[model samples]
Every structure is written in C-alpha cells, then in structure tokens.
Target: MKMKKLKYLSCCFAFGSLLLSPVFAQNPPESQADPQAQSSSSENSHPHGKAYRHKMAREMHEKMQRLMDKQDEELKKLANEMNKAPKDQKLDKVVTLLNTLVNQRIQMHEEMKAMHHKMMGNHKEHHE
Candidate 1:
C-alpha cells in the first residue's frame, strides 16, 4: 500500500508540473526575443499600423484639398475667359475656347496623376 501511495504522489507531481509548465510557456523572457523583431512586430500589429495608415491618409487628404483648390482656381479662370469671349469674333472665340479646354484637360490629368500616386503609396503600406 505504501508503494502504491508513492506512485500516486509521483504521478500527481508530474501532472502538476505539466500543468504549471505552460505558465512559463505563455510568455518568453524579455531577453530571449530579438528586440528589433519585437519592435517591428509591435509596429505591424493592428493599432500601430492603423495609426500609420491614418497619418498617411491625413497627409494625402491635405494634398487632395490643395489640388482641389488649384482646380477651382483654374475652373474660375476658364469660366471668366469663356464669359468674356465675344460671339461676334466666332473664329477667335472657338480658338480661345479650344485652348481653354486643353488647359482644363491637362489640369485633370495632373489631378489623376496625384490620385494615382497616393493610391500606390496606400497599397505599398498595406503590403508592408
């Protein structure tokens, strides 16, 4: 009976060790993991990455606002020139209006380029 009790005690001890070992497994000692890896891991993990994205978006938003302001100015100038153009000078008016159209097209193309650049930056961040 004493031998059986000894066996039971040893078994219980083994089981206890097995259960408690996981506590240590749950967290590594600070020195064990590479510091740079830890920092980079934290940076990519949800909150920090999300904050980075938000910051990028804010900057891009400001740039978009500036571009819009420029577009508005161009639009106002185009409108003014068209309004000032006379119907009596039809050929001259046509030429001026066509030139204005070309300028507006160029402005739109620049805006598109800016938008595309911002989109590429956003995509690169996502992949990283």
Candidate 2:
C-alpha cells in the first residue's frame, strides 16, 4: 500500500513539473527587445540626462558605502559583546549575533545589487 502511494505521488510530481517547465523556460517580452535602443531612448528622454545618471550613481554609491559601514560597526559591536559574555552564555549569544549578521549581510548585498542595477539604467523603468 505504501509503495503504491509513493508511486502515485511521484507521478503527480512529475506531471506538475512538466506542466510548469514551459512557463519557466520562456523569457519575459521586455528582455526580447533591443536593450541598446531602450537605454538610448531613456537617456535622451531628459535634458542633461547623462549628468543626471552620474549624480544618481554617485548618491547611490555613497548610500551603499554608508550602509556597509554601519553594518560593519554593528558587527564589530556584536563581536565585542560576544567576547564579553560569560562562557556558558556565549554560545547562545553567538548564534543570535551570527543570524543577525547574516541577515544584515544579505540586506547589504541586495542594496548593492539594486544600486548597480539603477546605475546601469536597467532599473529606471521599474524604479522611476
């Protein structure tokens, strides 16, 4: 009976995967268009657009740097706190701090990526 149920589940999973494959395989229509044309048109849409892009990039870069610096300071503080804790209590605190650091790192990475996308003009349509 268990073997029969397992086989049925496997068949269902296979069928589900097959049904979803095409949706995953197809690219979005936007990506199919000429990227150069889109970028050029977008850049030309505003007077002084090139300078504007440069200014935006600079601001985002500065913001990213600030975020990274703050995270680093927090991590260092956490490390110091971990060091000061009693040995028996240290393990639990370490785990908590580690999780916090990991989350902050992920957030920093995402922000950096968004900044890069914006700087590249790829995010203007969605961001603006």
Candidate 3:
C-alpha cells in the first residue's frame, strides 16, 4: 500500500512537471546594442500588442478547460469502477486508472505544446 502511494505521488509530480515544462521552455530575450531600437522592434514584432496575446491566452485557456473537464469525467468513471471492484482486483484497477490518467495528461501536454508552437510560429511569421 505504501509502495503504491509512493508511485502515485511520483506520477503526480511527473505529470505536474510535464504540464509546466513548456511554460518554462520559452526562449529568453536577447540583449540589444540599442535599447531604443529594441523597444521599437519589440513593439513592431507584436503589432496587435497585449490584446492579441491576451486573446490567444484566453483561447488556450478555454481549450485546456475543455480537456480538463473531459479528464474529470473519465476520472469519475474510473473512481466508480474502482469502488465497484473486488478487493482482490482493486490494486490492479487503481494501477490501470493511474496509467490512464497519466497518459491523458501526457496527451494534453503534447497538444498544448503543439498549440503553443503554432501560435509562436504565427507570431513570428506575422513579424517577418
């Protein structure tokens, strides 16, 4: 039981890391020789400014919310199954559900990463 709990905790930590890694992976700003030029270029780079970025962020948040809702439904179903499972099979059922949740999180992370990449690509193309 303790071993199972440890494994579950580790899986949760790994899932959290996967969810956060992309946010931390963003490229750092490069130093510019001219601050004025840098400021002007940055403004030009994002013509639409904060509003556009906020809109994109809002859309992404909606997408993530939908995905999470679906995951919640799946988890509820899994929990129901676990409750119905026999004592002898409960451990196996838990492990299976945990794997399912982990896989779902991984898929969510990948989708988010892809969406972020596409958004960045579009932003770059717009500037170019």
Each candidate structure's TM-score, on Cα atoms with residue i matched to residue i, is 0.44, 0.54, 0.60
Off by over 4 Å in 1: 1-47, 89-102, 110-128
Clashes of each: 0, 0, 0
Candidate 2, position 82, lDDT: 72
lDDT of each: 0.57, 0.64, 0.70
| Candidate 1 residue lDDT tens string, 1-128 | 67755665564455445434532233446763543554455456656575765687678778767866775686567556645866444334444444554575567567656865875676566657
- lDDT tens digits by residue: candidate 3, 56-87: 87898898889889987997898689769986
Question: Candidate 3 vs. truth: CA RMSD?
Answer: 6.5
Comparing 1 and 2 on lDDT, the stronger one: 2
Please give the lDDT score for candidate 2: 0.64
lDDT minimum window of 10 residues, candidate 1: 19-28
Best TM-score goes to which candidate? 3
Give the better candidate number (1 or 2) by TM-score.
Answer: 2
List the candidate numbers ranked by TM-score, top first.
3, 2, 1
Q: Estimate the Cα RMSD of every predicted model relative to the unseen true structure.
A: 33.1, 12.7, 6.5
User: How many residue-pair clashes does candidate 2 contain?
Assistant: 0
